[model samples]
Target: MVTFLLGFTLSVLQPVTGLRGFDTPNDAGGNITLTWESPDSGKVMVEIFRSQSPLEGYQKVESVLSSRREFVDTSAIDGIKYYYYVVSIGEDGKTDRSEILGPVSSAPQWFNTKRWNVLIILILLIIIFFIFIRLAKKGTKTYIRKIPGLEALDDAVGRSTEMGKPILYVPGLWGLTNVTVLASLSILRRVAKKTADYGARILIPNAEPLVMTATQEVVKEAYLEAGRPDLYNERDIFFVTADQFGYAAGCDGIIVRERPGAIFLLGVFAAESLILAETGNSIGAIQIAGTTSTLQLPFFVASCDYTLIGEEMLAAASYLSKEPVMLGSLKGEDFAKIIVSLLIIVGTVLATLGFTRIIELLSTG
Candidate 1:
């Protein structure tokens, strides 16, 4: 009973287990190295756990080598962040865990806010609000900004019309619910108007059925807005298979048969990103792609001509239509970034000086 109790005490202290040598390399394979001195004379195996994100649940990996003093992880994906922890198991089959040490992530982050973060957020909101008000009062050239990617649509549509072919606009997998999806749909509206104006054909191949319906509304509205309602075609903006690869295959088939001059892939995409872009590339179509999903970002960078990363995709929306809300949001985001930058600098200085106040603040407040 006494030995059992000691094991139990060690288990309870998992959150505070004293250890050392925790570091992570976010680039490449997203590996992290964990090493520590086993309590002298303690015959026990160490264990590790990891999670894809902070909010996710932890999962056990494997025990640390008994003879060795280190464990290096190689299973994590590049770009995405992961969390890690260590544990020790005793000879009697008793177990104890160390505190979670790492949350190594390669993906770039905009901010890390705590305590005074709220103040910084408020400052950003105010800045954005005022920018919009100022722009409205001045009747500024902010009337409408032009994104280069969006500007290409007219040329793509005209070329398609001249060749007696259709233009392919893929709103991606995120239906109309995602803000990026909505932005992509807004661009779809412009594409519809341009195609209608030149008497060209436009096809919206949607992976989500819901996007199929939304694209219909967006295209029809664009035609009505352009005073060419007769040019709209319901069959053009239709659903493809929902499976990512299946959708890519169907669209690839369409490209080979119909031969769209330009292909716009906006909003979310995943593993099938390169496949679709390569397909479009093979058929000699001008492709413009944008996405916020970090996992698939590299593929877009490699395959597409214009790839919008991080908040650039958001900025593209305002660039397209000059919406006050988006512009204001951008101002807010900038202030938020400034606040985050200041906090990072201050935190580094404080942490180096061993000031526990901020840690306490993070914990309690």
Candidate 2:
């Protein structure tokens, strides 16, 4: 009876109670906050444990002073339910555990409110794009500034015709996946049609086989569209080497032998740009060059008779084709740029005046 009474007294000396855990608020998930009230008995430390389920294995996560009542468990996985309990150790080395507070599962939010500014800006741009497209379809005119390189196409082809020499067009060394190459092809259609109308030969030496096939198709279509299908020659549009300098050397050989009166270099180019440009210059060819490669722009500007810089290369298609949809899209892009500029200026001024609401509103994060 005395032994049983002594065990009962020891159990009463150390006890743990009042444990609770819940999902963290205002979070992207994978977090839980736990809280418990310490027992009336004096304690030294409290240890936290987690388990997938209350009836299964439990792993120690953290240990805190007994005076602390709360802990945040950030290691929990999203969409997983977890159970947590705490063990309190007393000054006398006695230990007790609280009841497992459980079944809390972290969940991720579908949308992040932090990027609201990005969503708003994207929606605005989309609205602008569609608005201009609709306006253009209604026969509304969109004004585009004259691009000199694009405007001189007719004269360039005319010069080739008068000289009775082939017109050389290079679509650069890049593949069909490049936007610059696609733009070059669009311009080629126009150039091919002009050449067909004048009955002048047009030579296109490609660095990629796929681009050569595409160029041939585009040239043939242009000839057909010009009502001169009889003059279209598939042999004139052919593939050269894919090697950068090899293609440049082949083009230089053509410039030396065939001596094309007019050369059009339009697409993505690299170090070989100057090689071809300088060779065409030495051969007295009237070279009109356009590329998105900024590194090669200075060489083209120095060697070619006319150069289309940056956006002008992209604008050449819409300018030459005069398609309302493309023109409208270009106009819309300019309008959006103006809007962004204005917003930046306004935001800057407001920020300097200690009004940060506008700046904060535009921040993506």
Candidate 3:
């Protein structure tokens, strides 16, 4: 009777209470969330334990402050039943355990509801793209801002013709797989057409053999389009060395010897950007340079007469082509960017005014 009374008193003295375990929501499988009422007793540490059975094999999983009411067990295996409990340790090191809570398991959700905002935004953008595509097919013209670098293409070509010197076109150092190289190819077609129109010579030296072959076709097509296919010389579009610095040195030699009246640098470049640009600058060539490399842009801007910055180079093809499909897609994307920017501004204002539900609505997790 005395032992029984002492055990009952200790049970009643336990400070930890109301422990519960459940599958974590909006997550992949293999996780369980444990929650408990915060210990009301003075200064304590809470330890979390897990077990396969309610009565045995319990293992300590985590420890947190008594003020904490929740913990996530990331080690929980999917589809495996587990038991959990909490033990609160007082300042004096006395521990009080809560009743075992169990039979909880983890399973993955097919769709995380927390990412609803991502779904909505994606759907909205798709709808906008389709709308613009339809409008473009109906012959609606989309207005785009002028990029001065592209605007100077004609002047560069005219200058080369008047000076009676060949126009040097460098299709950059990267392979054809790069987007900037592809963009450069598009601009090349326009330059080739102009050169063909004026009966002027054009020289295209490439760093990649594949790019050399592709440039031949692009320039050939441009000349044909300009009704001057007979003047298309495959010899003019040739491959230079693939070695980076060697290619730069080869281009520098061409600039110094041939002294191209106008130099068009439009593609992905690295350290060689300055080398090529500076060489062309020293020759007094009418230089037009563009690239997506931020590190290389300052060099181009400083050395070249015309520099296409960032998206300006990306948008140059569409701007020059005036193809309805390309223009419409470009316009639609610009609108989507504007809408996202406005949403951010509005969300900021609402949050500052203590109305943060707008932010909550857009949260992805």
TM-score of each: 0.62, 0.79, 0.78
Question: Which stretches in model 1 have alpha-carbon errors above 4 Å?
Answer: 1-120, 140-147, 353-364
Best by TM-score: 2
What is the full ranking by lDDT, best candidate first? 3, 2, 1
Poorest 10 consecutive residues by lDDT, candidate 1: 13-22
TM-score of 2: 0.79
Q: Model 3 TM-score?
A: 0.78
TM-score of 1: 0.62
Q: How many residue pairs clash in each candidate?
A: 0, 0, 0
The collision pairs in model 1 are none
Query: What lDDT score is found at residue 64 in candidate 2?
Result: 89
The C-alpha RMSD in Å for every predicted model, in order, reads: 14.1, 6.4, 4.5
Question: Model 3, range 58-118, lDDT digits (tens) per residue?
Answer: 9999989878888999999999999988888877787777888889999999888989888
- Taken over the whole model, the C-alpha lDDT of each candidate is 0.72, 0.89, 0.90
lDDT of 1 by residue, 211-278 (tens): 88888998999888888898888988788888888888888889889888888888888888888888
Residue 109 Cα positional deviation in candidate 2, in Å, after optimal superposition:
4.4
The Cα error of candidate 2 at residue 164, in Å, is 0.6
Total clashes in model 3, counting residue pairs 3 or more apart in sequence or in different chains = 0
Which of candidates 1 and 3 reaches a greater lDDT? 3
